[model samples]
Target: MILRCNTGGTRTDNFAFFIYAFSSLFAIVSPVGGVITFVSLTSDMSLDEKNYLASKSVILACIIALFFAVTGQIILNFFGVSIDSLRVAGGILLFVVAFDMILAKVSRESVTEKEIDISMERSDIWIFPIALPLLTGPGTITTIIVLMGSAVSVLQRGEVIAAILLTFLITGVLFHFSRRIYKFLGYTGMLVFTRLMGLLLAAMAVNFITIGIWNIYLSFQ
Candidate 1:
């Protein structure tokens, strides 16, 4: 059976799927990223320092995304790593987050276990954990790089950036309504939803691990 490949349709479909997957992942992990940003900004930083740091972090996120877009494969190559392995690791992380969300245990260790020092309690909390890791942490950063590499066209940059911006905007609203959302959703609601997302994230992790191992095996053959 000679079936003609729908290159155009395939690319479009893939793009859409990638966008949603990435966006959902971002949304799921955003609360943590936001928290990180808020903490970093408000801790031991002046208003001007917070602003500068936030801007720097934002720029760094974009730069990291661009680097991954252009050299993600190269990065793997350099580290003798495979996308599958990366996926597996990422997937595991995602799954943990999802489980936490489902269970409603939204702790910092759900993502990174590093202890944060909130010494400068007088600083602007908005820019610290709120924007950085809470919004653009390792998971978010890795996802951006992977998606950037998946683009079928240079023009898709706009779409990808748009997707990121959209996610960020939504995240902003969530943060803006943090008190209210927490009040309404409550910990139980958050946990229920988080657990659901964890299952989805587990699927993603399996894919990464399977594909990564497969690729490694294939290379040997």
Candidate 2:
């Protein structure tokens, strides 16, 4: 059996795959990176209201994510879509988002402050910006669909679910303490982290594009 070792200790391939799944989801979802925006938008809310919003947003995001992960392939097939084409398109979308993130520009996929302002008057703000684009935008959905499509085994699929749950659990906790996290990190620290995550995402995007292209080429041969 092939084995790998790190400072932590020796690990098997399964463990490595879990780590890959978790990290990929974490990088794309980026709950911590969105804390500042979350805090800013919720500044006028009471503590209880903030808590309610956080909980609801997480619940909605989790549901949406699970739905896409489970039904992603069926949706693709129904639409006559191929996983390779989705991957290439999704990778390009991710690259655009990452480029904006690296430059500290609010990604078009994400809600702008003005949009948030307009959305604030609505009761479904939690469903819209908080849960929709903020937590599971096009890029996030694309990643979910692509990853689920790539899974070949029940165990691997379980690992993906585990990763999704873990990522969102952390997301809820982070939003619960959004104020403190924002206070601790401040704007500059948050910017640094956002940029770092952007770099990671950009790398992932390139990997996705490369694999998609390679597979598509192989299919023709």
Candidate 3:
């Protein structure tokens, strides 16, 4: 009976963790925003060309995300920054991003108009705005680092990795069908979705800040 109860509890905890990670990552990545940029950048391209670019961009983004997920902790340790400090800083940054999303403003922290212009001039944008700032920007990187840093066990780490992979896979699908999705959702629907995500992100940011502060306080004892 005890073994069965423990197993059930573990499963529940893992499921909850997965949900939290997925929601946080999805909110940060903002596939709706990606779709808008993807469509704008590839407006003159054929459907096949757009699909190819989407696939390439998504694969590259996944690689970058995974690399950071694996090495983010080490990088932080080398820089002598504690996870708690990172959590507080990342939370503040996310709050700023959420504010921008709520107002339907494009975040200059993620990408700038000048970068977009440069990308427009490039023949291959998969590595430029599309994959870099558009898909895996600093916000996404910080989120991944914080998530990975908080993983205490191998199982928890696996769950975080799974969440990252699943989020990127969904992002790829959304980008691949950007035109169809835009037509279906239209502008108003996209704005509504972005704001909803922003609200969730704001709540998450608060949670992160609370946890970080609590951890820091505990360390003093």
Candidate 4:
């Protein structure tokens, strides 16, 4: 809990970063929303099938997220894209998504009804709509990359990794019991929670935009 971080050679607190990583990822990933999608997609499956798909999809999503987070800086360098620039762009993208969520609308950046309908006919759905676009889509990937860019030291990097793992772990469990969750939370309850997470995500997006702008100015000076 007392973990410290060395950011650009200056000693600082890791606790704040840990919270930021965890909360922001949780908000963007929004396991509750994923669970609702899972319930609808797997309505015909038995408990065992539902559980298996849940585990598989969560594992695959975590792997994809980890890949981007671990190699985020390398990707940035290869594309000659600065983190500051990415933060601004990613931030704006996230805000658009958050705005959708705030209105209880599904963002196409995450997934769409047509994609979900098409996915229902696929055999490897756990890999398709569930793992790929549903759970860890463009918005989630961009958020991870932006967070990865902020993590400077080994400890900070580990924190980011931990956050990704924990987020998916919870998501897996939620999907495992999606039916019960749907019964408990119902559609209305889930929408309330989604809106709250969207508000949190919107705040984080603003922070990302502000930081990116400030840093860009500093680079010019």
The number of the candidate with the highest lDDT is 4
The most accurate candidate by TM-score is 4
TM-score of each: 0.64, 0.93, 0.94, 0.94
Better of 1 and 3 by lDDT: 3
Residues 1-221, candidate 1: write the lDDT tens digits: 33322443355565675576555546545543343334433445554665465555445444544555567768878998756567657656665655555455544532233423452453433334443455556666666655554455554544666666566555545544444555677656655555666566556655655765777688789
Least well predicted 10-residue stretch by lDDT in candidate 3: 1-10
**How far off is residue 201 in model 3, in Å?**
1.0
> Candidate 4 — what's its lDDT?
0.89
Model 3 spans with C-alpha error above 4 angstroms: 1-9
Model 2, TM vs. native: 0.93
Per-model lDDT: 0.54, 0.86, 0.86, 0.89
Model 4, 158-220: lDDT tens digits are 889999999999999899989999999999999999999989999999999999999999999
lDDT of 1 at 221: 100
Ranking 1 against 4 by lDDT, winner: 4
C-alpha RMSD of candidate 3: 2.1
**Model 1 misplaced stretches (Cα beyond 4 Å):** 1-15, 31-80, 107-124, 155-158
Full-model lDDT, candidate 2:
0.86
Better of 1 and 2 by TM-score: 2
Instruction: Name the lDDT of candidate 3.
Output: 0.86
